[model samples]
Target: MSVFDSLVGQSEVVERLKSAISSAKGGSSSQKMANSWLLVGPAGSGRSNAAVAFAASLLCSESGCGKCRDCQTVLSGTHIDVERFNPTGLSIKAEEVRELIARSAWSPSVGGWRIVIIEDADRLTESAANALLRTIEEPETHTLWLLCAPTLGDVSVTIRSRCRHLQLRTPSTASIEEFLLSNTSIDSKAAAFAARVSQGHIGRARFIATNQEARSRREEVLSLAFSLTDIDSCFKAASKILDIAQNQAESENSERDSQQMKQLQDAYQGTGRSLISGGARAIKDLERGQRSSTTRSVRDNIDSALLDIATFYRDVLVIQSGGEEILNIDLRTEVNEFAKTSSPKRSIERIEALLEARMNLGRNSAPLSTLEALFCALK
Candidate 1:
């Protein structure tokens, strides 16, 4: 298998990256030939994974053969040539962006492409983005900038318009299921459930399949969506949603803290605490990063779970109209009952209500308040 193979349902993007790496072999390395590339896609749509795979392709002789020493190192993120930046806070700072630009100025030591993959480039603050734009405008030889964002609108037009664009769509259920089953130890039945619940998010699918708690939380949330038939019931469902969101966020944040401790241990080696002020500084920095990550995770999880609920209503509409393809067949019985109770108009209204809440949340409304307002509106 190749690294490209790991990017499920993104054949077009895989082909484009392959072409770029292949052309670079004979073409002028530094003539400013669209060295910057923008990949826009929804959350959980494999945008970051695509950027990493593309970076791996440029790092290898035959386009990232998965078993090659180079590919293995790059995929595991230990490669020296490929640098990945996943900013933890809501904003990527100017100093950090300047550092990334400076790193990109150096030539690859391994006589191959030096790729910089910036995940969530959209989170760059205005100053940080300006710093990055200067580098992209005059990139060094053998350097490639792979910028991943949720949408072009999230990034400055000045930055996005200067780059080659590759947009990724959410994969189909069958594709997600195939990817999960091929990559993990999940059984077919489990893979199907994970794929359905995740709605094409590869990372979420893996989490659901491998973590029983996450799977149970999803089941419970969907059940609440199904049972919310009246005013009191809607409020109850909203409370459950808030609880699930918090629990998932709390658990994930705790796990990340544990992982940070392990990383700290590796860095500290045999040094005593009194002797390692740098280690203490690193821990404080890490905790700040982890806190920001936790906030983002909570918002992300709530939005995805809310979208799933909206999809349930969409499926209810499909079931009511006898559309040939009803989504969320995994909950056919509940969806059918919902279809029976809601007029197509009511179902449509319910979906719009969810979408409005999403917009409100995007505008910086609190998640708990958004959920309550949405549920109250539905009631």
Candidate 2:
């Protein structure tokens, strides 16, 4: 399938990117298309998908024909003309930005437009952001810099002001279900269920529809808001969340880490007869790095699910407060019970606590502590 097919309900963003590429190729100097672009949106709102599609368009023969070799390579992330930086670590280090800048200096080996995509521009360190600013300020012809961030507020004004803006919105349930049915073999009922539960997140919907285990986990998490009765219950929920987060992280990453460590420890005879030795300290350091990275990833991943849970409770609070149009009604029964016990004020305070916890994580605080504090505050 074409890359654009994944970005449902983002026609405005698609049109903006298409127009920018068209203007750049049309040689109509009368029209203005900025060198850099900041695609702002909520998580799972097609920001990165739009960026990838735009990069594909920049490298395509007929401006994103979807059938050309350039388009195929870009979509597959093997394009010589296109480079994507999507680090999942704590920060985008200066060295990484320098590498991207160095790569930008060279012409595309494939003799097409060179596009750089910073998938999580919000994760850029201050030094890395400054380093990126140097090239973005005075970009070369045939160069495109596309940055995807959660919000305009997450990015520096210096970078935000320099780029053209593309804003994407979450897709409607109908659109999400239709896309899932068209793209995947998931049954219609399951697709609809996932669409409703995931709250417009295509990625999370796919997860919910694909894995029974994931569905169970989400079910357990959603049921918590209703059963939370006392401070002890809050602590129980927090500890349970922490356990689930850590276990899921281990399940996802431990196998790879083990295999890597095994390979590192294995004896190998090289061409130069050089021995590969990873000492105890080196191995420990590697393990430490992996652990730290995994911890952050796990926290963020868990936070995504928690945000949905919080949304569910927030909707319940809104319903109790006589607010119209409850946003997260997929768990209506559970929410109804939650609204029955907790005053609207209480539920709102809990939601605020969740948001504050998320903010703390964004600021590099420990997730375990932040989560504990949130539950305690909710209590």
Top candidate when judged by lDDT against the true structure: 1
Q: 280-365 in candidate 2: lDDT tens per residue?
A: 66678668778767977688776875786787877887779887566555666666766777787778788888888888888888
TM-score of candidate 2 relative to the true fold:
0.88
Question: What alpha-carbon RMSD in Å does predicted model 2 have with respect to the real structure?
Answer: 3.0
Q: Tens-digit lDDT track for model 1 on 1-379?
A: 8888868888888887777776776544554336899999987889998988888777778767878878888899988888999886657899999999889878887756788999999888888888888788778868899999999999999899788999998988899999889989989998988887677788888888899877666667777676666877877777788777777888768976898788787768766554166777887878888888787777777887788788788888887777846656678888877788778888889889999998887666888778888987765
Candidate 2, position 106, lDDT = 78
Query: By TM-score, how accurate is candidate 1?
Result: 0.88
TM-score of each: 0.88, 0.88
Off by over 4 Å in 2: 27-29, 255-289, 321-331
lDDT value, residue 88 of candidate 2: 51
Clash statistics: count for each candidate: 0, 0
